[model samples]
Target: MDNIAGTKSSLVWAVNIAVVVLVLLWTIPTFGLLVSSFRDRDQIATTGWWSSLFPHEASLRFRIGDAETQRQEGEVFVIDGSVFEAGGTVSAFGTSNRDPAAHEPGEVVDFGDGISGTVNEDGSYRVTSPVAFEGRSPRLFVTSVTPPRFTLENYDRVLFAQGLGRAFLNTMTVTIPATVIPILVAAFAAYALAWMEFPGRSLLIASVVGLLVVPLQLALIPLLQLHNAIGIGKDYLGIWLAHSAFGLPLAIYLLRNYMVGLPREIIESARVDGATDFQIFLKIILPLSFPALASFAIFQFLWTWNDLLIATVFLGNTQDQLVMTGVLRELLGSRGGDWEILAASAFVSISVPLVVFFAMQKYLVRGLLAGSVK
Candidate 1:
């Protein structure tokens, strides 16, 4: 008894420690992505994502006077309002956004020309020179402490910038139908395979399994030809058909296997009570196969949602028909350095998957194989 208790206690302690370590490993990066997604583009590249969660010091540089306002003030050339009453200790300033810490506040930093500036920590800075910069932009850097700052800039930029809004809508149009049609068609086929035996049943099952090995690329050109002949043209309808075709083989295989495992007696009992195949299927088979249906839904939905290659071909690359994946790909080429935008967009794309998993998780089973063992 003592030995058993000791072993169990030791195992529990180890498990707890392992869990704690794993959680930390997953947590820090995820937190970084989450924080990074909300920061401004410049802030994201300069500071670590973790910095967004807490306040950090930032500097702001503002000028007080223009060239025309330059006047002789006692012993020096002074511009009207050039002296900022609101001043504090300067820490650091940089000429470029790439490095905001090249110079410390209160230090006069040279810009290779006559331009020089002194920054203070109180969000106030002064730039002085022999000549005044009037009627033009004077570039200066300020370094101040900024607290944790988050901006919805990335999400806004992703949704409104470029043609992402239209692409997002297009993705929804394709994904919803692509996901629904296959499940509906595959559900019926799976039922027929599992419960309703017909001529060449084995051959049909083998054919579906065989198709699982076929690469989608091999059929792309042929499928396009078929679509054009059928007058579907290159549009959402065509993409839907393409996705449905690619998704069906796996869908039928999975759903049929699950449906075949349902209790035979329950199906038989319904049949004996004068219930037709359709009625029994509608009332008894479907209700019992909820787990299987949900599982397939999750699979098909996610697959169609993330699809890009087929979308590019069937739906056309035009803004009106492009999907989220296509839009995101374009953004990668055009705005590769915008990590915050990328992270935010990535999280946005995964939101539906997360919802799908959580909603249908109960259907994901460990024991559909229970009867198999017997």
Candidate 2:
């Protein structure tokens, strides 16, 4: 008994460790992206998101005031300025671009011909020459330790300048109707398959099961052609139909299997009360099937919201009609190196589906488990 107890304790430790590891794996990256979305472009480029939480050393280069602004101090020409515009402690400065941090701050370096320069810790700089200054101002490179910085500018630019807000509305326009049409149609079909006696019922169910394994890519071109032929060419309506058609098979299968599991006595009792088939479905099956309906609704909502290929094929990529996913893809291509924009856009695109999933998670879990057991 002692040995068995030891083995159980070891198993529990292993399971706890595995759960912690899995949670970290998912949480770390998502947390980093969220942090990154709020950071400025320079901070994001210069340091990792993990470093954004702390003060870090950074460097920048700036030019001294132009010769036009130089003042004469007796025999010496003088130029005065600050390395940092908003003020920062300067750790180092350099005259040459090739080695900007070659000299430590507050150290003077002679540029020959009676020309010398020095930068203080407060980023104030002085350049002195025996003769008048000429041409453009000489450049200086300064390194400093910057405090942790955060901003909402990335979100502002993406939502306003990049038109992500419009794309979000467009995605909603496609997703809502696509999700609803399939559920309504599938519920009716599922009820018939589950409770009504019909010819080829088994064959129809088997066909739907087979369709679940079929690749959606195979249908894209053919469906596009068919839609065009039917005069629906490349519109929200066309994409809605395409999503409905693609989503229907799985929706019907899940809802029908779930409906099949409902207690037969309830359905039979209602039938004995002279209730019509439609009334039985409306009153009895619909309420009991909430879990299943919610499960399918979440599935369809996520699928339609995240879909790219179907939207691309059936809907044109105009600014007025492009979905959030399409806008994100465009950002990936156009702003390939802009991590702040990309991360902010990605977080925005996924926010709605996350909310929907969490809101209906209980029903979704119940539907899936109940359907499987029954």
Candidate 3:
């Protein structure tokens, strides 16, 4: 009964649960990054994004009004102001540096000789003394619970102030050309390999398949030397060419596999209708091959967008020419302690890839699975 041809398996629920867990494992961190990106630097430093929704308790030190601001209120000299004007509830406070939360909110602390101070729950504080104050204001330590805070300042600081905006544009410039050029070149080559007969077609296909296993690292130095020899060194053009060259083999292989699986009858019918090979490829093959194209586009886009090594080797890491990844690396080294900025920058970096993946994911399986069975 369990093995019945049309019946569902008991493990279907297990598979679903596994998939849900995997989705959560991936999604939760990305969601946290998004939440952290919007949070204040101080909040991100002290607490995790999960605790961002509720009030947060922190011990903070602030200085009361200076003696210059003290005035006579009948017989007593008083200094009145707020410890936290930005809005928070002070649950506990103290006048001494040693014991910050010595008394509950609204309870008075006596220093000496009629000098007294009290802090209210709303962060206001009043200090009174029989004699006038003379010098610096006393320091007040407080335990406060503040509402969750979110801000765009992290994004603002990274994007505009830290040069990520320029790097973003530079990355787009590198990635778009890199992705598109290879796909165009590989589509033509793949068409030739799949549909058009040639003397060395078998060897060519075999070579492409063989190239897939070759590590990009092996070719980096040779390719860089070649580029320098050809006078295309350390520029956008060089990186674009490098990415396109590195990506071409896989693109050709994938597109060839998909194009080979296309119906023979359609090609024959087009030929019978007196359509030339070029016309058939343009009019019939491209439309039919959209899934494969989209799949390769997603791959190439993701690789080029996230790439650091190729960009570094091909495009010199000048401040003006650095890609997003390079700029991010700089930030990591320079602002390693600034969690909020890193969170925002990381989210910014992954956002485009996420959009590209979700937009084209429906075709990914179709493209990769093309010709696998038939």
Best by lDDT: 2
The models' CA-based lDDT, in order, is 0.74, 0.88, 0.87
lDDT for model 1: 0.74
TM-score of each: 0.75, 0.83, 0.87
Better of 1 and 2 by lDDT: 2
Model 1 misplacement above 4 A? 1-5, 8-14, 24-31, 57-121, 125-143, 364-374
Task: Itemize residue pairs with steric clashes in candidate 3.
Answer: none
lDDT of 3 by residue, 50-168 (tens): 88978888888988888889999899999999878578899899877789889999998896667898999999999999999988777789999998888999999989987888888
Residue runs of model 2 more than 4 Å from their true location after superposition: 1-18, 60-63, 72-78, 91-141, 367-374
Give one digit per residue, the lDDT tens place, for model 2 in 1-374.
Answer: 55654567777799899999999998998899999999999778978999889877777778888998899988889999887765567877788878988998889998676789999999899999988988876778888876777889999999999999999999999999999999889999999999999899999999998987799889989998998999998998899888998999889989998899899999999899999999999988988988888888888899999999888888999998899999999989999999999999998999998898888888777766754564
Identify the runs in model 3 with alpha carbons over 4 angstroms from their true place: 1-24, 61-63, 94-104, 107-112, 134-141, 368-374
